[model samples]
Target: MTHGRQGGDGASDPESAGGGASDPEDPDAPTPSDAFGALGGETRLAVVRALDTESPRAFSDLAEATDADTTAGFAYHLRRLTERFVRQREDERYELTDAGRSVARAVAAGTYTASVDRDPVELDEPCPLCDGDGLVAAVADNVTEVGCGDCGGTVLRLSLPPGGYAARDSDEFADAVDAHHRRRIESFDDGVCPECTATVSARIEPAEDEADHGASHRDDEYVPVQTVYECETCGADLRCPVALTLLDHPAVVAFYHDHDRDVRDRPIWNVGSEWRERAVSRDPWCIVVSVRLDGEVLVCYVAGDGRVVDHRRESREEPSARADADDSATGTHTDDSTAVSTDDAETVRANDTAESGPAES
Candidate 1:
């Protein structure tokens, strides 16, 4: 998974995956433009396509697969792809390098050449915003959308890669989109960029205002606070509501566990009313995300930098039943929202979940 992002800076003798020490400013090394320029022709593409991608192939076998009129022509195209995209093995068989495999994967995924649109298909999940039962999933231009049919509010929006959507029906497409966002989000939560594995910086800010990362999701359809993550190295970024950051937090997971529900199984748009996030402070940026089930409430105090400063749970002596089969919650917080502090009151389970979920687009 290593790339050229390294080897250009730091260290007296940075090591190359090659047995020799890396040369930071090797004059003959291929430039980024040169690496891409080699793949511009049909002949070069034939060589890449012939690779199927990984098993090493003899030079004669590769030359036989391409439509090159002569072996010299095939050899010329192979030479252009060598070093950066294709590499020759010690056994004299040809294989793709990491960058070459990346191109093959992109080609197979249809990322650069595919477009898709699927009519709205009604989803069984309810809208978290309006609590409306008429929720639907739709795909257009390679992006999947889940919105409320009643309120016309968006529940989830994610740009899915073509391979994740093209062969799937609406239900499978929705599941694919949810799973994709969940992985990227989990990567972001771990303080790493999903694209390049760079250390990402994070902060919480007003949804309607742009943060330092040039992030602005300021439409009336969004929440009050939005969380932003940016990779200073790769300049990649991700945005979602502040509540999204707590989907895997220990207290929140335990609260859902106690109610006999798996929070991770719930769709990104059907997270229940307890997820209405708000920031009680902005100068120091402290966020309040509470998950309420029956008369039991779980409160998480989060800092602006996406850290959970503190958390506590308040429950009735005997809380009500778990959320119903229709995916709706029961029992609002009683007048005594702070009903417990003595022994049975602020009891939070110490369990933490490894899986995370998407709460926003």
Candidate 2:
């Protein structure tokens, strides 16, 4: 788990080279080997779980909590965790640092210690593409998937830490998952990786129209293009219909609110006709997505970069459907869920994912 490094060249402090990561010679700078090495053994790990709070814990208490090879050996391990994961106060009491707290909670979240899945929970919503039945939500390998079994196509897929499902009650389970998952999507839309807070790059490309793929049953009914955001470091992948990037946009949210519907209450697949995108171009990328409510429409001009640059509203009976209008400057911007982006579309998939809490299930 790489962290925001806090080292500076303490040119005078024997341990520092005066510049942090910039100075490869800075011995005190945060490094993968050193950060992870601090928790390499059971003793060190136990120490992290023991001092899980900001309140200082005396050395004796930490040692007693994690009785190790020996008191001296335990003390040595504690020393190793000192700056990167632990902090020592003036009175010599110790506490977990910000990164340390994150580690503790993540462990509790079951990212490092658990694998989970659940039986399919039948959903009342129909498949957006095929209008098929048997649409259900299931978890496997820690990823939550919602799709139609009959067509064998996945409509939506996202990673969920073990706690994502295991911690919710049946009555509120689905809504909780929706809120959590949507937040992750919003994060990606903002050009930020929810997992590691890294800069996320974005682009637009043709969506997979494979008939055999999940939900591609409609010969011409498919998300024609998608916006993808990828973490530069941790490999978190988030892909969605270009319109989905506006899921939280003020205008979009207000549009749904005015219609007596809470858009956030349902998954993107369930939103059906309310949210949609059809590409306007591929080069430099542009997309026109319409949110239709009560025979009225709101057209958003999205650039390849995923930002909603312009918008207009019209009655469904209006003369021309803007779907055919070309908006050429759509900004350009992942396989977290399988929208099936292609080779020429600039797909970015990360083999390694960051810590698991709040990630796609």
Candidate 3:
């Protein structure tokens, strides 16, 4: 007889199908449809909800909790959910499995509800784009969004957990949502994922569909641009501005800190204009980035191999001999290393020999 086939005598054979019982780790195991079908019946769903309590309930207690008219009907439903949604303890009590608890929570959170009202509240922060004082926080369709009334810019938008809305006041909730986004961006800038610790890569690219996609902020009225970062392992990506990514660098943080400015204190869109890129040389394929801040401009030259070749900072104020002297004394005007000086203009070549350090990646 062929293996896994019936014998000519019609007698059962145990050795044909691997000579053993079915294995849970088999490659051809059943799909998730079986688990989903287990919850299809109303009675089974009711049993799952009844067992989602803090403590396990006895079989009789569960039947009563579900308000089944007869114990036989309740037992039938419980049997259908057993080992899938409902787990039976040694003491003959039933409780929800992790899957069962998740379904129960979804039901309780009104995941299937047809509609929800938007909860709107006023915020105290000003709009970075329009300098307007009309920032509002609202939750609609489970997403929490912060927007400006004057310029119609959607400043911050994020989705919260099912029950996250009722957990805090509006302001606190807004702060929590923004904090989560900030942490994600910072983690991406640092070349890793905050949640999974996976390595990431970043690049600056123009926003798609310029006519449809306005600038980063509403008041800018220019083509939108974005700095995109993607995790090499997880396939997760984040999009922001090139300036924002630069602000997360340690060198930029120290530079602004020395100028009596805290980069973290201001919204990213308000810190500087969007970075402008240009091809400085075609034969050598050199690219440069120009970014304008409050009273100074920064120019960074990058070679074709993607290394930073040079960086220069120019102040709007006139050059001062005393300021230059102090900057040189502090080793800030050195041509070889990454340092900033108070002179009218200071250039630092990537090959400089000063001891401070190279520009941060």
Number of the top candidate by lDDT? 1
Which residue pairs in candidate 3 have backbone atoms (N, alpha carbon, C) closer than 3 angstroms, thus clashing? 336-352
- Candidate 3 local lDDT, 1-361, one digit each (tens): 0111234686645443233433347656334566667777777877777776555988877777675678898888888788577888998887888878978987777665533335788777677668798878788876776788889988656665545555576667766655556677778767786645777776545556545655333211223345667655445666754445555555556556667776676543344333454432323333445554565545565433333446666663422343355466864442222122322122323223235544554
Point out the worst 10-residue segment of candidate 2 by lDDT: 331-340
- For model 2, the superposed segments whose C-alpha errors exceed 4 Å read 1-27, 169-172, 209-223, 319-361
lDDT of 2 by residue, 1-361 (tens): 0111123552233222222232256755777656776778888888888887435799888888885868888878888899689989899999988989988988778888788767788888888767888788887877767888778778877666778777775444566667776788788777787887878787775667546466433322334677777666555666676766777887777888888887676666676756656653444454667777887777666666666655666776551322222112222221111111232122211111113221120
Q: Give residue 281's error in model 1 in angstroms.
A: 1.0
Better of 2 and 3 by TM-score: 2
For residue 68, what is the lDDT in candidate 2?
Answer: 83
lDDT of 1 by residue, 1-361 (tens): 0012233354322222222423346967776567778898887777777786536899888887778899888888899899689999999999888888888888878888898898999988777777778889888888777888899887667788888876887668887777777777778888988887878888876766455435533221223677788765565567787777678777777778889988888666566665545554444555557677776777666666777756767564422222121123323332233222212211221111113332221
Pull out the clashing pairs in model 1. none
